[model samples]
Target: MAVVFDRPSLWQRVRPHLRGFDWLLLLAMLMLAGLGLLAMYSSGYDHGTRFVDHGRNMVIAAGIMVVVAQVPPRRLMQLAVPVYVLGVALLVAVALFGISKKGAQRWINLGVVIQPSELLKIATPLMLAWWFHRREGQTRAFDFAVAFGLLALPVGLIMKQPDLGTAMLVLAAGLAVIFFAGLPWKLVLPPVLIAVVGVVLILAFEPQLCADGADWVVLHEYQRQRVCTLLDPTRDPLGKGFHILQGMIAIGSGGLWGKGFMQGTQTHLEFIPERTTDFIFAAFSEEFGLVGNLAIIAGFVFLVLRSLMIAADGPTLFARLLAASLATIFFTYAFVNMGMVSGILPVVGVPLPFISYGGTAMVTLGLALGMLMSIAKEKRLIQS
Candidate 1:
């Protein structure tokens, strides 16, 4: 007698790998990615192979996200320290002998040219979350201090590279982890008050502080120029202030309903600088207008909220902290990019998530979101 054996088809064989993914998270990502493609096609129509390269980058990012989603959060905790160490080591190497492009020494030549600062974005959070996880239920001021130490090392290095935008992102990621891990309100409020007061003083003394030959010791010359330009773009509208002025003009030109796709004169005519990358939001706003901006914001809001919910459902303290902190990376990316484009913040090289044409940034975004998906997937596995 011959026995018939059952064979699993391709769908059945692959189903397990696809199971437990957060569909809502994926939906939000897809919506934003679709928007990015549209924005890129329009803004990068004549900008070399940017549109094609962007599409290729998105595909690579999506593949990475899917693969990273399979890694368990518990396994990721084990990786925290080593990844952090590797990131720090690479940063040191960059400082000693790194590539400088456009006056920023932020990239290191490691076989293939790489930006070590981007690694810190994820590593800093992972290290802090792991620290908090180990100290859970018994965390103290010293633990928070250690956490800050882990955070500050990379942030300082990035600043030395003088890439303030990347430093701010790394700092924000670590702070989110610490805050979620039960940092004291007393420690938080002082900085908040100081920052508010500092802003007030800056605005009050804009003219004196921004006068030619005036210097802000804490900021690099270019950074100072950015702040001064932000204060008044009309000062040298054709020189240092051109970016801000052009961005404002493009944004305002969109009015309520945008200029309709590729018809954006500012974008198509090359008036909006970096229209395919950092300032793509201006390009997007020019074409899609206020309504489009709202939709973009809403998509981000959904993604962030969904990530926090994933954090809340996390099975372990490490998972919760990592997920929450990683989610805020998305928040920082979107907020800073949009604010700078809208002329409310400094142009600090931050990219809008899924909407900016950047290989490094998109890869970092994929890895961060993948970690969140892993946490959410783990929770589902536990429940099942």
Candidate 2:
């Protein structure tokens, strides 16, 4: 008689790993992606292949997310410095010999046009999270100062490129990490208060501050115009105001239940500018109405909340900060896109996450979400 032993099959061996997956987050992402596909199809009807391309991008992003989730947080922290250095080097390269498109030199020609700022959106937060993680429990005010310096270097370079949208995203992501790392309120409040006061002053004396030939001290002429347009789009009705006006009109017309999917007059009539990109929110609002808007908002809320919960349960300080920061990135994208489309914020070219048709943004988002998944999985593995 011979004793025989059977080895476990591949599926059986891999099944344990599958148990660590976060289904809730996966569901929320799928819901948002589905809604995005619907919106892109409607908004990009006349734009040849946009709907298909958007789907392709989503698939690619999902694949990136899956691949990234497999890399544990420790490995991610190890790569953080290298990634940050590469991103900054690319930004410097862009400054010196970057490709210029539409009056903005924000991309580098590496056989393909690549936006370096996009890389920093994830890398900056990762670097900060890793930095604070190394100094966990012994962090001082001086450490925070060093972190801010780290944050400022890349942010300043991106701002010089004059890509306000990408700059704002990176700034928000870095600030989220700083805030989660427990930066004192005294340090945080002053800048926020100053920003509020500045906004009030700008609105109070819009006619003067925005008057012709008035040079805004820190903002470029176009940036100043965007702020002024946000305050009063009607001032430049046929010029800088057109996009805001059309967006507001589309949103207002959506009413309660939406005009019905693919039935938006503003969208189909081509009145909404950048329907496949920055202003896609208007097209969505017009067709989906208030109900649809609420649904999409709910999806984003779930995603953010889930990520925050993951951050709260993260096993390491780095994981916590990184997860929270990534969550804020998603919230910032949604809020800015919606606010700008509704004429309440400046038109900074921020695209609605998932819904907007953009390759770089989609890839960045996928990476952030993947990192969140990695943190979540790490926590799960520890608990098990």
Tell me the number of clashing residue pairs for each predicted model: 0, 1
Compose the digit string of candidate 1's lDDT tens values, residues 44-121: 989899999999999999999999999999899999999999999999999999999999899987688989999999
lDDT by residue for model 2 over 157-226, one digit each (tens)?
A: 9999889998999999999999989899999999999999998898789899989999988899999999
Clashing pairs in 2: 258-289
Top candidate when judged by TM-score against the true structure: 1
lDDT of 1 at 343: 81
Q: Please list the residue runs of candidate 1 whose C-alpha ends up more than 4 Å from where it truly belongs after superposition.
A: 1-6
Candidate models: Cα lDDT each: 0.92, 0.94
* Residue 361 displacement in candidate 2 (angstroms): 0.9
The number of clashing residue pairs in model 2 is: 1
Which residue pairs show collisions in model 1?
none
The local distance difference test score of model 1 is 0.92
